[model samples]
Target: MTALAVRQIGPPRLTKGLESAGRLDWDAHRALHPHPRPLTTDQLIALCEAGSLHGRGGAAFPFARKVKATADSAVRRRKRTVVVVNGTEGEPGSAKDKTLLRGAPHLILDGAALAATALGSLEIIVAVTDPDAAASVQRAIAERGLGARARVVRLPERFITGEGGALVRGINGGRPIPPGRKSRASTRGVDGLPTLLSNAETYAQLAVLAGLGPHRYRKVGLPQEPGTVLLTVTGSARFPAVVETAAGAPLGHLLDLCGSRAGEGVLVGGYHGAWLKGEVATRTQVSRAGLAAAGGALGAGIVMPLGRGTCPLGECARVARYLAAESAGQCGPCRLGLPDLAGALTALASGQDAAAARDTVARAARMVTGRGACAHPDGTARFVLSAMDAFEDDIARHVADGGCGRPVLGVLPAATDARLSLEVDWSRCDGHGLCADVLRGTVRMDEYDYPVIPSEPIPARLEADARRAVAACPGLALRLVPRTAHDKPRPEPQRGR
Candidate 1:
């Protein structure tokens, strides 16, 4: 993680070039920050509107829109607003946020401060879980003596903890899971005051643009807007690193940097992303516009490797379960639906009935969707459902012949990781039937038996039932497995019958 000198500049930033992705310490951002008057909210909005800067965070929601939403607030008496820098990088496959937060903390801070100034905020919190990232940001804060106005907050290590809203919850000492309902962090956030939350890179980009102004910023990228974007190229790369390329840099140019050695197909945007069979150089453009052309998103700008060695269906099943378990469990569709959806994938991956699997998937999609409070459930469902569509051929093979030719490589996270294990304390088992009633997909009553448990993963629609199983467990044998890498399923003496 040492910073190596890349060629020239000002503030030190990290980049994964085609040649080398190692940390480089070139001073591209060391120039004096011009002490321009803090732009009025309208001026800031114009700067964003002129620059055409998409959200550096995956969502690409216009920064101008978020600013307009929060900055234009009409609350009679406003609570002191806080601006949150989300650096969780929760997606296991994405590393862009961590890279920016670790290497260019000051640039991010400068941008956040600019935003805070615009929003009438006095406090800025740079939140992250990665050790190196946290330390880097903290040191930058201390070195600049910006500690009073800007601070760094270390967070509990977990995947779901990175969700935008979840990160807000983490900051306030609440559980880091997303809530059952959607509330804009910019509206009702951080100590019940309207907070402006954005990914770390968004701030960095804002800083860069603030320093350069809209005209200079528009020089490099498309005329539709102007500016560059940073992306983390992973999967199969000769020398993968963070890249500072033109906004909507053609994937071809980036792939050229990758050269011949890249995994066949790719997963764009990270874990909460989509998988496709293609490369960047020839077919697709890399801009939000470009990615949209490819029917994909430039989410968090993670270019993951979809190596050919893994079975696509098995891979889908694996990640599906992880995504399901990663749910904040606040929304009904995501909590109940994801598990069921993931289960269907597991069943298909293991050679279950194809027709039944398809029907079950369709049903799960219908039941758990639109019922969630957050987009997590909806996004997870979209990912799984799209995967099924994307790799229908492999899925058919899993059903008709019981397997895809490729081995189930660990490219995707485990599908059954936390979902299959139903830990009910025998002593606590009152046989009250709540767990069974709630999670019939997992547990059921058998003749003279406490509960019949299925060893397989649950469906997405049944996620609520799983939670209810945990909540309703009379003996409190049921417990939720928080979303974390260490959550391994427990082994059992008796197997599912």
Candidate 2:
């Protein structure tokens, strides 16, 4: 929900007509990109195939393949195809989709509208999780006078809410989690109709491709992956920004532009992404193939460099714990495996037996991979495993000695619902261990068996148990309060056996 700085590495195409602040108006958008002649289905597919434009939403799926499949599905099923523009950026590290939605809403709509026209579909749904992005798209829809055919829907802001199946399920009036079984959105999506869903930036690129044609659009980036990419450069960097750069740009250049020297290492593609050694990151290119060769991914175009001041192992453990908490709990891997994986990583970071913890992490990761309803478990495994490799030296120090002497600075961001806290009233308190017993992980018992309440905000998952523990207290000395109220001083407990 923080404001992001926007920058462009080279000539801007997707960010072309962005004004100083606020959404670019309809008139200004038209002046910059006059609507091109609408492309027929075949023509649109051909142009996408020729330009090699792919989805910008992590997967890098071929746009031509998606369009062709959706068109074919619609014809075969005798149902009109639906178009979904996914702006629900559940990946906390990435903001390119949200940026496009806020600054260039029309461009995204233009692209979606073109696809709808080409596919002969009447419905175009713009799904967003951010309030600002939702408002911007709504205003853009009204401005374009496409309110009847195009509309906006707000989705729950969860990490899994942006998955293709989950986004479609949310749009279709279901819980926003991946389905129990795998089904392509192209075959069955919104309203049980064939659907064409893509990230917001992907559609914006489509609009650009439609206007510039294949020949012109292919001039900027690589022969295989054409045009530009939008990157969310964050963590340890002097300037955190949403950057637009040509595909195949050197990774080091972007880091330097953002004023980062890859202090520890760079995390590419977000939490579900892998970490690159600082040196390999410097030599890598900003494309899928290039990153793959370097043992990294271009997943969701997120580049976060871990600085030297923070404990890399601690940061990885924190994110791993968050990922475990975020599991939809729809499968064995999520319900059981991720928590075990996170616990092992946390133990390793806390200076536990390194060899045993490492083995636990590796074994748990293997158990979770390819065993979930979606890629959540697999991605989580990938992130933890890569951290083990990237921060091996730090791990060694933590094992040989006690630690690296670095604190967990929390440079990498994760969604934490820290709204509530457990407070104890020392005046009426006995040295009962009920609170500690009930909330075992969060609360601890002291030498005299009095409750030792943690200073950290309570995670949402434990709120229920926390409330129960508060009520079950015989002395009624514990209560849940707003996190701000917990910082007030309480009398020291009387020491006794």
The candidate maximizing TM-score is 2
RMSD in Å for all candidates: 6.5, 4.6
Residue range 242-358, candidate 2, lDDT tens digits: 999999999999999999987769999999899999989999999999999999999899999988878888788778877876767799998778877887787677565666777
Which one wins on lDDT? 2
lDDT of 1 by residue, 1-497 (tens): 22222221112222322124332232333543443357777888898888876676778888998887776552534566888998877776666677666666667777888888888886898888888888878877776677688888888766677777788888989888876566888777887777888888888778778887888777777898476666767555555656667665567666556542334556666665665555442477777777766656778787755555666766766677667766666656765677678777666665655567777877887787677776676667667776676677666676677666566646544343233345556776767777766653345454355665554355443556677778767678666444445544332221111
Q: On a 0 to 100 scale, what is the lDDT of residue 321 in model 2?
A: 71
Q: Cα deviation of 217 in candidate 1 (Å)?
A: 0.6
Question: Which 10 residues in a row give candidate 2 its minimum summed lDDT?
Answer: 488-497
Model 2 lDDT vs. the true structure? 0.85
Q: All models: lDDT?
A: 0.66, 0.85
In model 1, how large is the Cα lDDT of residue 389?
Answer: 65
Candidate 1: which stretches are off by over 4 Å? 1-37, 236-239, 259-264, 279-282, 413-497
Q: How many backbone clashes does candidate 2 have?
A: 0
